[model samples]
Target: MKKVAILQSNYIPWKGYFDMIAAVDEFILYDDMQYTRRDWRNRNQIKTPQGGQWLTVPVKAKGKFDQSIRQTEIDGDEWRDLHWKALSLNYRRARYFSEVVEFIEPLYQNSYRTISELNRAFIEALCVYLEITTKISNSWDYQLIEGKTERLSNLCQQAGATQYISGPSAKDYIDPNIFSDAGIALTWFNYEGYPEYPQLWGDFSHGVSILDLLFNCGKDSPNYMRFVKK
Candidate 1:
């Protein structure tokens, strides 16, 4: 039976995002939603003199804009230079810093900036690099059967999935009985087992963005996800 997971598209998210993708048979980028400001979808952290500052990509705001993951814009291409410089300065001493930094530098400069596009492409690139066999698809292509709960379950059934795993956010309020009503077993993903790297500031810090992992660990990142705890 196939396993499926759905998550909001984010900009170059952490190892956990890839972890979920790597662990599942099918992964979907849920981009059919409101575009939030100052959210993970819009910006992320990078090492800065101000102690891990957030670098935001500029976006045009409008009323209830239901922007797809492919449409967002990267407001400041110049910022990419600042980011690359900062990472180089701070992580030059890291074990695999040079290689990882070299590998991602072109991506930072040449790739498109919309959060959705970046994430979708990043996951695709990383998955191939890591040799993951899981198949991925965009949610916009299917007719999601309606009834938030039934919508997901029915869609999974349509895709030949027997199990559905959701983010921990589902643990608090998602109605499990709804899945039962649709004949799909449900579970949740908890982000744990963050790996330790040469954190410039302290012994360990969580949530510095995936760039932090790459700058410090390089190719070791794919295996680091194996440490995730339940």
Candidate 2:
């Protein structure tokens, strides 16, 4: 059976996000949805000596509340150098920092106008690093229907998915009956029970960007993650 998962693209998302992608057969970047300010679409946390620090991509969100994630343009290119600098300074001592930086640094150097493009680029690169072979697609590639559950269900049908895998947080609003009605099974992805890897700073944090795991573990990054096999 083909398993599918749909989620908005996130900027260097945490390990759980990649776990969700690895659990599915086809992962859809649902960027057609409206963009929300101060969300994962443009920012994510990174572990630091002091504490968890947020690396936010400055986006032109003022007065454009109705814009979709795919349409959300970055405010300027200035944030790129600053973000790279932060990663370099914080993770320079990480065991595999140099190795991960070889590929990741270029991503920052490249210019991406929209948040969707930026997030997708990072997500896809991380998936490759973790050896996840899930097919990634854009939400706009399929015909979207109205209603929240209806649209998700329709996307599954269009993608020939027999099962739909979703993050546990979506359980609150996702109606299982909608999938049942469409002859698709709904499965909630579990984010619990993640074993802590060699982390920097004081305490262990599971909410930081996947880059933390990559920097510390490099090729063994899959060992700390759930769905991706080592």
Candidate 3:
């Protein structure tokens, strides 16, 4: 059965995001929707020795009140250098830091005009680093319909999905009736049962960037995540 998951692109999302991606056959980046302020769309937390800190991508959202994620532009080029420096400082002492630094450093060097593009680039890169083979695409590529749950169901239909899996946070917004009517099975993704890994901070945090798990676990990262080897 073909399973699909649709979610907005997040800046260096947590391990749970990749867990959802790994559980599905196809993953869709739903960025055609309106962009929300202070959301995972443009920023994420990273573990530090002291605590977890947010690394945000400053976007030009001053005049454009109703900007879509695809249309949201980076405020300036300086954020890249600053973010790279922060990551280097925080994760430099991670167990597998040296192994993955080469692959991740280039992402900061390159410039992306939009937040969606930058997020997608990092997501795809991290997926490769974790060996996830799920097909990824942008939502604009599909024929969008109206309504909250309807739009998601339509996207699943467009992708020829027999089952639609989503994060538990959408339980309030998603209507099982919609997916049922579409002959699609709906399942809520669970983020429970994640074991603590060797982390730098005093408290182990699972909500930081996937990079945290990668830097700490290296080639054994997938074993820490829900992704199962075939």
Candidate 4:
């Protein structure tokens, strides 16, 4: 059976995010959904000497509040250098910092016009390091129908998916009956039980970006994550 998962693209998302991607056969970037401010779409947390710090990518979300994630434009190019510098300073001493930097640093240097592009670029690159070979696609690539559950179920059907894998948070609004009606089996991805690796900071946090795991564990990063095979 073909397993599918759909989620909005995130900026250097946490390890759990990649875990969900790795658990599915086809991962869809649901950027067609409306963009919300102060969300994972533009920023993610990172560990620092003091505590967890947020590295936000400034986006133009003032007046155009109804824009989709794919349509969202970045405010400026200045945040790029600031984010890269912050990561460099905080993770410079990580065990695999130098090894991961060879690929991670250049992502910050390249220019991306939209958040979707930036998020996808980083997600694809990180997947390579983790050895995840799931097929990634965009929501707009398929014909979208009406209703929340109907749209998701329809996407699965269009993609020839027999099973749908979703995050637990979606249980608040996702109607499983919709998938049942479409002859698709629904499964909830568990993000628990992640083992802690040798983190640099004083405290261990699983909510930070996947970069933390990569910087600390390098190729062995998969050992600390769920779904990804070591």
Candidate 5:
């Protein structure tokens, strides 16, 4: 049976996010929704000298219409510089520092100005680095990517998916009958059971970006991901 997972494209999300994608046959990049400021698209956890700090992509809100992920512009580039500088200083003494530096250099150079593009870059790069082979599709390219839950149900059925996975929060509002009527089985991505890797600062970080694990553990991070059992 074909399985699928739908998620708003986020910036280099933590390990469990990728695990959910890897668990299914088709992973949907659900990026057509209204963009909110100060959200996961712009802010994520990263290791720092002090501890796990939130690295955010500053956007010019301009009090405009709820911006599109494709429209949100990267404001001051200072946050990018500061984050890189901090990571450089803190991880310079790390064992896998060289590998981390090489991997992240391209990200700093690109300096993505829009949320959708930035999210795409992060997800695609992570998939490549992690060797994930699941077919990824952007929701905007296909119809049924819209605000209502009915549309989402149709999208799942149209994709020829027998199973659909979503974040745990989805259960609160999305009527189960929608998927049932469409003959799509629904499951929740329980990310509550992920394992901790070799975190840099000797603390448990549950929600940081995946780059943190990659940087500290190098190629061994994949081993930790497997520790998350059903």
Candidate 6:
């Protein structure tokens, strides 16, 4: 059966996000939806010696009302250098920092006008690093319907997915009956059993960016993420 997952693009998302992508046959970047303020779409937590810190991409959200993620634009070109500097300072001592730094540094150097573009670039790059072979697509390619769950269900149907896979957080709002009505099986993904890998700083946190795991564990990073190929 072809399992499909639909999730918004996130900036250097955590291992759990990639795990979900790895578990599905097709991963859809649901960018046609409204862009929420202060969400994972433009920012994400990164582990630091002090604590988990946010590295947010400044976006121009002044006049746009309910702007779709694909239409949202970056505010300025200044965040790139700042973000790269923070990562370099904090993760410079990571075990495999040198190995992964070359590949990751260029991403920050390149210019991106939109948040979705920047996020998709990183997500695709990290998926390759983790050996995840799932086919990735954009939700804008499908004709979305109105309503929350209906839009998701329609996206799955458009992709010809026999099964719809979703994150556990969606259990609150997602109706299983919707998928049943669409003749698609529904499955919930759990990110609870992740084992801590060699992490920097004192306490380990699973909420930080996947770059933490990649820089710290290098080739063995996939071993820590569920569903990722070894």
lDDT, residue 20, model 4 = 89
Model 2 regions more than 4 Å off: none
On the 0 to 100 scale, the lDDT of residue 142 in model 1 is 76
Alpha-carbon TM-score of each model against the true structure? 0.85, 0.98, 0.98, 0.98, 0.90, 0.97
Per-residue CA lDDT of model 1 for 95-147, tens digit only, reads: 77777655566666765657677667766766665567688887776787656
List model 5 lDDT by residue over 91-113, tens digit each.
77766778867767677777666
Which candidate, 1 or 3, has the higher lDDT? 3
Best by lDDT: 4
Give the higher-lDDT candidate: 4 or 5: 4
lDDT of 5 at 104: 76
In candidate 6, list every pair of residues with a backbone clash. none
Global Cα lDDT for candidate 1: 0.71
| Predicted candidate 2 versus true structure: per-residue lDDT over 8-76, tens digit per residue | 999999999988888888999999999998889999999899999999999988999899999999988
- Give the CA lDDT, 0 to 100, for residue 196 in model 1: 65
* Candidate 1 local lDDT, residue 67: 64
Question: Cα lDDT for residue 46, model 6?
Answer: 83
Candidate 3 per-residue lDDT over residues 65-160, each given as its tens digit: 898999999888898898899988988999899989988999999989999999999999988888889999999999998999999999999999
Models sorted by lDDT, best on top:
4, 2, 3, 6, 5, 1
Using lDDT as the yardstick, the better of models 1 and 5 is: 5
